[model samples]
Target: MVQVDVFWSYALGASFASAASRQLKIKSNPFQNDYFTYTLLYLSCIFAPSGIYLLWQFPHWETMQVATCHGDLPAWLVTIFSITNITQGILGFWVSYQCIKAGRYYLAHLQWFLAYFCMFFVLVHGWDGLGWQRFLYDPTVLNNQLWEPGQHMGLTFLWSNVAFTLYVMGIFVIPFMIIPMSKWIIEGAQNSPEVRSTDIPESIQEIGITFLKLVLGCSLGGAIITSIVIYIIRLITGNLLISFIFGMSICLVSGYYFFFQEGKICYDLFKKLFLAEPATSQKEKS
Candidate 1:
């Protein structure tokens, strides 16, 4: 039920800002435009939701170019899918913006991570090659073809894949570190003196490039380090899941330091960007 959509990414991005916002928190809202939140929220709705709709409606749309099922996707489905993605994003902004207005930090965090965590299974199992079924419903998570660049290694051989470790860590795991990282940011931000006002991002119509930079920075840093940690653990643990599990815990500690690890290259880049302000006056701004 918990679809891996932009919702999780948005939540993570929001949490990152919100957690850091605790530092910027004033008794009153800054009421400034938060392109970060808006960008993530919008991105989440567009890519994952409509993308999933296309995949579901077409079944194996990825294979459509060569497969006989290419014509199954209807123009109606396209219309509906586009409609739903936009509407869903708008609805999400409404609800999340309300929570932010009310300072319900934990409530918003709960909404995202609850579903985000489930994706780890999909990430792991997905590379397990074709015929991988869920324990209960027995659904095909992946239908990897031999001609495809993907390999046929299930969980058994997958755990030891160095490249695969890097791939998953970069795209999914490191970005995932945002959840815990945001938790710390929230706590850190909250501990500061309350501010007078802050902007509700959704209320504003503005855009910028920082959101992409911020996500990529942390994801890049977190992924590289975490992948190394997982690989090291893999050498000792000799199991993909176990190695990843341990690596995840390691990321928790790393996440905290990354926010403050000055001059440390990749990790600290996240800190610099996360804690950055476009201008001196923008400190308390979202």
Candidate 2:
């Protein structure tokens, strides 16, 4: 299962990155874009179920008011937040496109960042809204009134959110960025050996390889650990929300340790077994 998780993560990251890169380059090089286009179609097919599930579970206004922020958000405020989120996302893309047309890369990035912030807030608000279900399962608790938001529950919700955001960044966004950045680096190196030797030294390349390895390990190990923890918590507590929170905690800790510590050690050991003595010597300082 662990190996399966690792393999799936690597495949997904690589495929998604490659597909996105291909799409971006399609305007410049339309030839042979068919393969990636087909890949994207298949990828979308695979992701459709998950997307459907999310939409199915998405909170309505009644639940959103009680589940998210302070547990008493007015319907008008929720409507405003939802509208702003959607509007900003569309505007942000348009602004980014205009900025790129004007060759203002930094400004484009800022616009995109603003869009991301709006989208993230909306997502977190939805997750917080799910907290309402924590009380729904209890027959003793009245369904008429909103449950009081306790400090412990609020903090746990916040922490789970932080973990989930980081997890997505580590496993998804990073790979997307890396695919393009690595292509740029490789192209630069090919065009100018001097740039390769000076701007991106062997040490830097090794560091990148190590980081990639850590990410792979963390993606695999973290998923396995999180699943096990969630399963155990659910069995013991018989509460979906509590189990999810506990799972997020375990996922965060295991991911951190694997990415920063155990993953590096495992990568180093693997390299030692396969790499030549000269290669090992170059890595020794690291």
Candidate 3:
């Protein structure tokens, strides 16, 4: 939870700072903007409130090579951790500002995206190198039987599972959602100048299609990008950061085109199969 909230704080800072940046045809969506801030802020600031959460909750995993117990959490350590989160948020904002000012909006997204994912990797694998220890240790899990009558792994096990699940949704899953595309849809509503009290969809099917398109488009884009990038990186330098950097760069550049195309494909299919037209469209052609 400590790592998760802190990461969201940084990501929230970066994502919000990318305001007013221009893409070729892309305009920021008002609804998407509010939604983004609301979700991230609610999880990060409102929930645990990172700083206080750290001081009171203590840390399970060794962060920066230091470990502390719950009740004995050093004020100084908490202070430092809190400072780091603050500084990280500040830095994220700074980086995003520069990126957006330079017309590199994708880099701004990368700032937070990279931080959260890197920390996630560290949190999972770098917890005394025992992240995988509990998973395969269970006899039932190994035997392909997940649940049993008696399972006692204590608070460490319980909190780790619960926290990671929620964090994954907040940090990873939410980002891949078609918030940006929905923003474009909102832009269409605004520019059209037709009567519209709201451009955002209120129905489940409409919302589901947006998310479904985002996932599929990004999946296809990711697979293609990975294949090309791995080949090039292997031929050059096979650094982990280099791979990640390349992956994000391509996603912003050529990858976006693919997302747009793939999203169109999904939406067209949905339109043909179910939706007569956009659910929000009330204006009739004369």
Best by TM-score: 3
- Best-to-worst ranking by lDDT: 3, 1, 2
Judged by whole-model lDDT over C-alpha atoms, candidate 1 comes out at 0.41
Best by lDDT: 3
lDDT of 3 by residue, 56-112 (tens): 443433232133345455778666665555555655655665665554544555565
Arranged by TM-score, best first? 3, 1, 2
- Candidate 1 has a TM-score of 0.39
Give lDDT: candidate 2, residue 108. Answer: 38
**Candidate 3 global TM-score:** 0.43
Better of 1 and 2 by TM-score: 1
**lDDT value, candidate 3, whole model:** 0.44
Q: Quick one: RMSD of model 2?
A: 14.7
Q: Put down candidate 2 lDDT per residue, 1-286, tens digits, no spaces.
A: 1101222222432332222231232234322344334333433343222222222232222233334323344666545443433333333334443443443333333342223322222323224333323322221122333344442233353344323433553564455444443553344344432222343324335534644553444333444455567667888999879987886677666544664232455434322111222222246545
TM-score for each candidate, following the candidate numbering: 0.39, 0.32, 0.43
lDDT of 2 at 212: 53
